[model samples]
Target: MLIKMNNIHKSFGTNSVLKGVNIEIQDGEVHALMGENGAGKSTLMNILTGLHKRNDGTILIDGKETYFKDPKEAEKYGITFIHQELNIWPEMTVLENLFIGKEITSSFGILNTRKMKALAREQFDKLSVNIPLDQEAGRCSVGQQQMIEIAKALMTDAKVIIMDEPTAALTEREIQKLFLVIDSLKKQGVSIVYISHRMEEIFEICDRITVMRDGITVDTKNIPETNFDDVVKKMVGRALTDRFPARNPNPRETVLKVRNLTQKGVFHDVNFSVKSGEIVGVSGLMGAGRTEIMRTLFGMDSIDSGDIFINGEKRTIKNPHEAIKLGIGFITEDRKDEGLILDFSLRQNIALPSLKSFSPKGYMNRKDEQDFVDMLIKRLTIKTQSSETNAKDLSGGNQQKVVIAKWIGISPKVLILDEPTRGVDVGAKREIYQLMNELTDRGVAIIMVSSELPEILGMSDRILVVHEGTISGELPKNEATQEKIMTLATGGQ
Candidate 1:
């Protein structure tokens, strides 16, 4: 074995995060760490990487007992951790960012830029990455940033690398590229700990699986020994016979229409319509103008030439307030930043959009606000100490539920969900799927933008594939396959 952690225990305040969790990794294998958001996965990894002090545990590397005092010590022992959030200086160039803390220097203490950049280029080329080293790191796309981060790890000559949600922001092609990189690393006998919510990638990449629940290691299985359904059952302690809820069998009249929607450089000739009780999924790679089109429809951005018809009425929506008045709600991609006020209480966030309903005649009605919040909390199954609890205190799943509850209270005619299930656990994803089913059943037209092919294929009544600021193709659920969507997204006929 390359690494081993036994009887790991950790606690913060009075809450115990890990309870005797155990994990082991062999050389040259991609080991998957599976768990819910708060199921102690991060805590255990933090302890191993020396970010947090474990209450009790034993760590062994190369058949020798060892203790890592800090991240530097862990790195000294040939271990590296790549955080889910890309840790890079936006202002620095790619080569400069890679050698941030540990820069090559001459005997006179001057930077050895020539040697460092040559080494960086070698690492990038090994991963088949082609970005210029002199370019600003932040100017590159998310996938490019991730590849650079991995190359930076290789720059350290790390024997073991831990990647947390590396593909969260990557497109299908980018993900395939990353898998190739991983394969190359495995050939070099590097051990990788892969953590992510996407199940397909886990099955495809990992050699073995270790499931964690609450604070303990539930089971570990080889890739061929266990299946997706069994893994989901072990992780969530329940059986999900179907990941997605039943799709709307019949869609009614068209509730919204976009006729030749064009936003100059952003998107051109984008035309799509959503009918009541229908889920119209927008599928494309990042920068495909999906998000821009959604923002334009939601009145966040202006359209150069187009007409929007809502409920058979041609209306010019100048802003979100106008869109809201016209019964439209948009749940943005970054829920923490765009959807909810982190410092505010759940009740406050839920009542923010429709506060006027409770504050009739210039007087605030406290009872009405309380009653509304109470109803939503119970109805949406938002787990919290109380409605008065701060939004930041909830888990990723709960926080997302709060975002959905806030919009559900408004009950818009058109609900636009941009990457609705991003950063959420499988259980929460299922819950959100159920909520979408309920909304469509109540005649709410939905427009969902997703990068996950399975999500689009599972939940959508029809899919709109975008390619470089244009709608390349539209696919029905029956005809939509991952390969077909990828081909269309890449501008195939």
Candidate 2:
């Protein structure tokens, strides 16, 4: 075995995160670490990378006991971590970001810029990455930034690499490129600890799978020994009966109508209507302008030419605040950058959208705010110490739940959700689906933007396929299929 962790234990105050987790990895295998969000997968990897200290455990590398006191020491031991959020400085050049702390220095104490650029180019060439090394890191696309993150890991001569939700921000093509790099690394006897929530990726790329639930090791199996159903069982500690709830077959009257919505150089000639008690899913390939459409509809982006009709009456929403006032809410795609306020507590985050209602006569009502937030916290099943717990302290799924709760407090008639379950676990996905069921049951129209075809097929009453900034086709739930959606999304016309 190349790495072995036994009886790994960790705790955060009264919360026991990882209890007796164990794992053994061979030298050249893509081992998947699977679990529900808040199930301690990140904590286990954090311990391995020296981000967190295990209260009690043993880690063996090459049959010898070892320890990493910090991330630098972990890197020195040929173990590199590629965080889901790339740690590279956005303002720095690609070459500078790659060689960050380990910049080569000449004998005269001058920085060896030429040597560093040469080394960085050699590594990018190995990965088949095509981007200018002199370009600023922030200017690169999300896919390119991920590639640079991997290249940065390669610079350390990494024998073992930990990838956390690597495909979360990548397009379909970029994801394929990443898998090819993983294959190359495996052929070179490099072990990878792949942490992700995507089911298809787990089955296609992993050789072995380890499941965790509520901070304990559930089961580990070879790819051939278990299937998706069994793995999901281990992940959530229960069988997942269905992917989506039974939605209303006949929707009510149209609640939102867009006519000739145009955002120059982005999307144009868009026309659609979302009906009450229905889920209208927007499906498309990456950069097909699905998110852009939603942003424009929510007034985040100014539309060049369009008319929005709410309840058969036209309204010009100059900003999101106006849209919210007019009974429209949008859950943005990028949670980290645009969603909840991370530094604030759950009470503050949930009360954000409905602050005016919770207060009256220009006076803030503390009790009403806390009570309202507490009610949503319980209703949403958000796991937290209390309503006062900081939003950042929660897991990915819970943080997303916070965003939903905030919007729900507003009671919007039309709700736009962009990639609602992007980085969440299977169990959390089910919870969100149920929440959607409740919302639709209450006559709220939902516009869901998703890249996952299965989700669109499973949850949508009607599917809108967008291709290159235009609506290519629309299909009813019974007629929509993976093949048809893909054809339209790829501009089949």
Candidate 3:
């Protein structure tokens, strides 16, 4: 299968998303779509998959012009889009989620349970996924959920598969398995549109790359012809000298400390401390209780037994409200649900935590709120038409920035960041790292839980590797290596 999108244009009211974009995808090859968040890469793919209609463009499929009426119609024509956002029905079973719309039935219209299981098993086997078919989808870890989505796409036997940030939640092992599957699919003549901000993954697996910036295609080159620096320059329209900013750690007294924190069956005996003006990076495989620990600290989950201390004084955090009042801020991993309310405006989301401060004398101070929002928008370099724009209107990277800004409004003494740059681009990532440096410079202690090793090694003052439910090893910045981190993460001494 081959696809060509020429002069694509898309607009939502007055906001233009994609303008005169072009791309060509060849058969049996993995084509990378590289861009900063909101650069219209996903928009262009949405147009091809019929989720969004191109206001002006031409789509040619195998030398014939084709426009699918909807995603279902496009799936019928062998095009499948595995979106960045996992669309799992949390309450549904894994088997049910796999065959939701395309359930197999007998001649009498009775559901064929046995046949569906057989088909689902086959797809899961191909992807090496071990999730239970009868288990609730929400019960699975984020990495497991990601695999389910991949298996769902594979079940379609799609001629063209569009993967948008597919490996964002996957572990190193799962990512290697996925890469092997991509190689197999290429051999089987399946073309993949690989959309990701991870430069290393793109260079390793893709055959060609298309760079998009500001709603237009900047350039397309074969993987061998383009370097990482070149692709990044095209995507951001600027040169990024460093992926992470340099930090001068000035450690002070401990701001937050946890001793023998037990979440029972989830995590146990987790002991750690974050000094003022330090970044403690937590490294672990997905589902290794990293997020669980952070949630407990933020009062999202109750610990079986633990001692949480703030500045040498013991504190009890029963809920998020209490945690906030204690000067602790949490930036959750799932930004869409926990971080920001999509329908809320940028100002509303940014002002949510600081509303009490703005409401002096029991009255809403509109001027103070507006000024605060404007400062964050400029400080974080958030790209938007205006502060009144809905949170959902911004790109993934900008939404993350809004989440950080929301936490920053409170001037926290300790901030817990879980996957701070999970889906962010290189340029935005640098900005975030710089911001972390700035925050720490202000004597804020930061505990960052991350899956990416390079980020941990580059940005952290110290690294703590989580294995199973315990902290297995801790390494200082000058002594840490990827090999050491991976070994510790897998329960090695």
Candidate 4:
């Protein structure tokens, strides 16, 4: 075995995130860790990478017991991790970013720039990544940045690598290239721990699979013997009767409309509308400008040209505050960075967006805020001991609830969710879907942008496929399918 984790137990304050989890990986094998959003897969990986201290566990590398005090220590033991969020300096060139910590030094302690660039180019070529070594890392596309992160890990010459949702933002072509790299790594005898929610990738690259649920190991099986449905059933615990709820037969009058929306290079000449109590989904490949449309609609990005209409009345939105004032709410894709204030308590995070609503004569009403937060927590079934808990400490699913609660508190007429369940687990995803249903039933118009095809098809009343910068095609709920969406999204007209 390349790595063995025995009876691991970890907790944060009163919340036990992991409970006696055991897993083992062999050399030259791609071991996939499957779970719903807050199922402790990340926690286990964090422990292995020395990002978090385990309460109790014995980790063995190559038959010897090991304990990592920090990520550097883990790297010394031939272990490296590539997180979902690429950690690279935008200002630095690829070469500089790759050799950040281990810079080559000359005789007098000066940096050896030439040698580092040469080494970086060699590593990039070896991994089949075509990114320019001298270019700034941040200037590269999201897919290229992801590849740079992997190349940096390779520079460490680690024996075992852990990748967390590495393909989340990648295009189909980029994913294929990544698979080729993984294949090469396997042939080189590198043990890979692949963590992803995309079931297709698991069956494509993984040799063995381990499912985690609420911090415990659920099951482990060979990929050839198991299938996506079986794996999802194991991860979610219950067989999903229907992936998406039935769409309402009648959508009410148009509640929101965007005419000739243009944000310059971001997105151009975008047009759409949402009826009251209707769920409209925007589907496209990453960087196809789906997110830009959402941002522009929510007033986060400046629209060079376009007009927004609420209840058939044209209105100008100067910023997010104005958008909110006009009864529009937006939930960002990156919850950690844009959605929540990590240091704030759950109650504070929920109330931050709508603070004015709970204020009388410019004085904040603590009791009213507490009562509202309490109600939302209970209604959302948020798994937290107290609202006093820091937002950063909560799991991904709970953090998402907090974001939802913030917007739902305002009682907006139109809600826009950008990848709302990006990292959430199966159970949490079901809850979110149910929440959407409840919201729409109450006459709230929902505009969602999602990368998951099933989510776009299942929950949407209408689907708009965007390619390049414009809508390639639009389909009603019954006519929408994976093939149709892909066809339109890939410029199939």
Candidate 5:
């Protein structure tokens, strides 16, 4: 199938999201939709898939004007969208989720469980996913859940598939497997609209690229004809210097220390320490207990046995409130679920952690709260029309900025960042890195749990590799290499 979008315009309450974006997807090719956060890439896809109506545009499929009434209609027309957010039903079984609306039924309207299972199994096998169909979807790890979404889309037998940040939660091995599947799909004459912030993956897998900036199409080029520098320049409309900001560490006393931290069956004796102004990077394969360890430290989960020390004083933290009171902050990995309340305004979310300060007299001072929120929005460069804007209205990168701004308001001594740059664009990622540098300069100790090896190597003063819920190896910034980190992460001696 060949897809074409011309002069597409989209808006929400006078906010112009897409202002004349144009792109064409060829049959049997992997086309990349590249842009900075809030650049209208996802909105364009939403228009094409019938999630949102384009105010002014023309979409052609097979050289004929086509507009799907809804996403289901698009799916039925052999177009499938695997969104950036995994749409797994937590309470439903994996099998049920795979065939939620499109279930198999018998002649008498009875459910055909046997055939559904067989089809689901076949799709999972094609993706090399090992998840059990009967298991609760919520119990699976983020990476496993991502695989389930991929399998669900594949089962649609889609001629055109739109994948947005599909490999964000996947491990190296899983990424390789996904690439293999993409190659196989290409051979079968399927078209893939790949959307990702990871430039490496785009250059490796995509055939052609279309970049957008400020809701307008900037340029489109073949993968062989373009370079990383060129694409980033077009997306941000500026030249980006270094990928990571310089971190000149001046370590003070240890601000946070963990000794023999255990979360029962979840993680084993995990021990690490972070000095003031130090970035202690926690690197490992997905589901290797990195985020679990951080969650326990931030009092999100109960610790079966562990010793936590803040500024040389041992403390018992039973919940997030207690952790916050003790000068600790956590930016969770699952931003949609844990980081921000989608319905809340930006001011409300940013002022949540600092409510005590804003309400010292049992009443919030509106001016003070607004000023604080404004300062953070400007500092983080969060692109929003106003502080009263709903958190869900902003793009993914802006939502992440809001999450960071919420924690930064509390002025915590130790901050735990889980996948700080997970789905963020390159420019926003650099800004975040620069902010990390500024925070450390203020003597804030950071424990960053990241699955991206390059990020760990780029920003860390010290790196700790976790293998099987244990600290397999620790290396200083100078001595760390990608191969060494991967080796230790895989339980190497």
Candidate 6:
């Protein structure tokens, strides 16, 4: 084994997140760490990468017991981690970000700019990545930034690499490129710990699979010995009868329409309509303008040209406030930045968007707000100790539910959900799907943008594939397939 972790135990306050988890990864093998959203996958990775201290465990690196004091120490021992969230400095150039701490220096200790650029270029070429070496990392697309992060790990000559949801934002083509890189790494005898919720990806690339549920290790099996259904059953401890709720039989009349929508460099000439009681899915690769289109619709972005029709009447939406007042709600993809107020209690966050409903005169009504939040909490089945619990203290899945509850409390006519189930567990995903169905049944039109093809295929009444800032193709639910959507999303003619 390249690395062996035995009896790993960790806890946070009263929560036991990891309990005696044991896993072994071999060199040159892609080992997948499978689990639900809060099932200790991230906790185990954090422990291995030295981000958190394990209460009790034996971590053996290269057949010897070893402890990592910090991430730097783990890096020095040929281990690197690519976090689920982008960790690059947006203001710095790609090359600078890649070699941020481990800079090349001359004998006199001066910065070796020439050598660094050349080395970065070499790494980019070797990995088949096309990101500009000198371009600011912030300006790059999410997919490009992900590739840069992978290249940074390569630059460190890491023998063991841990990737957490690496393909979450990548396009089909980008994912293929990433697979090629992984193939190369495996050939060179690097141990890979792949953590992803996408079952297809785990089956396609992993040599071995390990499943975790509720902070415990359930089983580890060779990829060929287990299938997707087995893994899913282990992760959630129950067979999923239906991944998506039944589609609406009677979709209401068109409630929102976008005609000739244009956002210059972002998206151009986009046209779509949403009918009440319908879920319209927008599917695309990273940087394909899916989120941008949603942002434009939500008034979070300024449109260069377009006419929005509400209830068969044309109107202008200048900002989010205008959109909200027009009965539109948005659940952002970046929940941390756009969805929740971490410092606020769950009740406060849920009541924020709908404060007007609870306000008495010019003053806020705390009692009314609390009542409204209490209703939402019960409706959404949010797993929290109390309404006073800080939004930041909730798990990834619960935090996401809070975000949905916040928007659902507003009771908008149109709802836009960007990656509604991005980091959520399978069980939570099912709950969200059910919630969407319930909303549609109540005559709410939903526009959903998701990178997961399974979700798009399962939930969408109509699927629109975006490519290069344009709607490449549109398919009805019956005709939409993974292969077909991917073809159009890659600019296939």
Q: Which residue ranges in model 4 land beyond 4 Å of their true spot? A: 85-96, 104-148, 227-233
Model 4 residue 262 CA deviation in Å: 1.9
What digit string (tens of lDDT, one per residue) describes model 1 on residues 196-313?
A: 8899999999999999998899998898999999999999999988888777546999999988999998899988899999999999987788888988888988999989999888
| lDDT per residue as tens, model 5, 47-91 | 999999999989999999999999999999999999988898999
Model 1's lDDT to the true fold? 0.86
List candidate 5 segments past 4 Å from native: none
Quote model 4's TM-score: 0.90
lDDT of 2 by residue, 311-382 (tens): 999999889999999999999866666787889998888998899996688999888888888889888788
Give the Cα lDDT of each candidate: 0.86, 0.87, 0.92, 0.85, 0.92, 0.87
Residue-level lDDT of model 3, residues 317-367, one tens digit each, is 999999999999999988887899999999999999999999989999999
RMSD of 4: 2.9
Q: What is the lDDT of candidate 6?
A: 0.87
Candidate 2: what lDDT?
A: 0.87
Badly placed stretches (over 4 Å) of model 3 are none
lDDT of 6 by residue, 1-493 (tens): 3799999999887778898999999989999998877788988988988999999989997889888889999999888999877687989999889999999999999999999989888888876677778899988866678788988888888888999888876766678778888988999999899998777888899999999998889999999999867888999898887777777646889999999899998899998899999999998878778888888888888999989999999998889999999999999977775799989999989988898887759888888888889988888777777899999877666788999999999899999999888667667788899999999999999999988888999999999889989999999999888999989989995
Positional deviation of residue 47's Cα in model 2 after best superposition, in angstroms: 0.8
Candidate 3 least-lDDT 10 residues? 238-247
TM-score of 2: 0.91
- Residue 392's lDDT within candidate 6 is 81
Candidate 4 lDDT by residue in tens digits, 1-493: 3789999999987789999999999999999998876788888998988899999989998899887889898888788999875688989988888988899999999999888888888887765678778899866756578778988998888889999988765656567777888898899999899998777788999999999987999988889999867887888887877655666635799999999998887788888899989899988876788877887878888888989999999998888999999999999877766799999999999988789988868998999999999999998878788999899877776788899999999999999998877666666777889889999999999999887777887799899989988888899888888898999988886
Which pairs of residues collide in candidate 6? Answer: none
Q: What is the lDDT of residue 250 in candidate 4?
A: 58
Model 5: lDDT equals 0.92
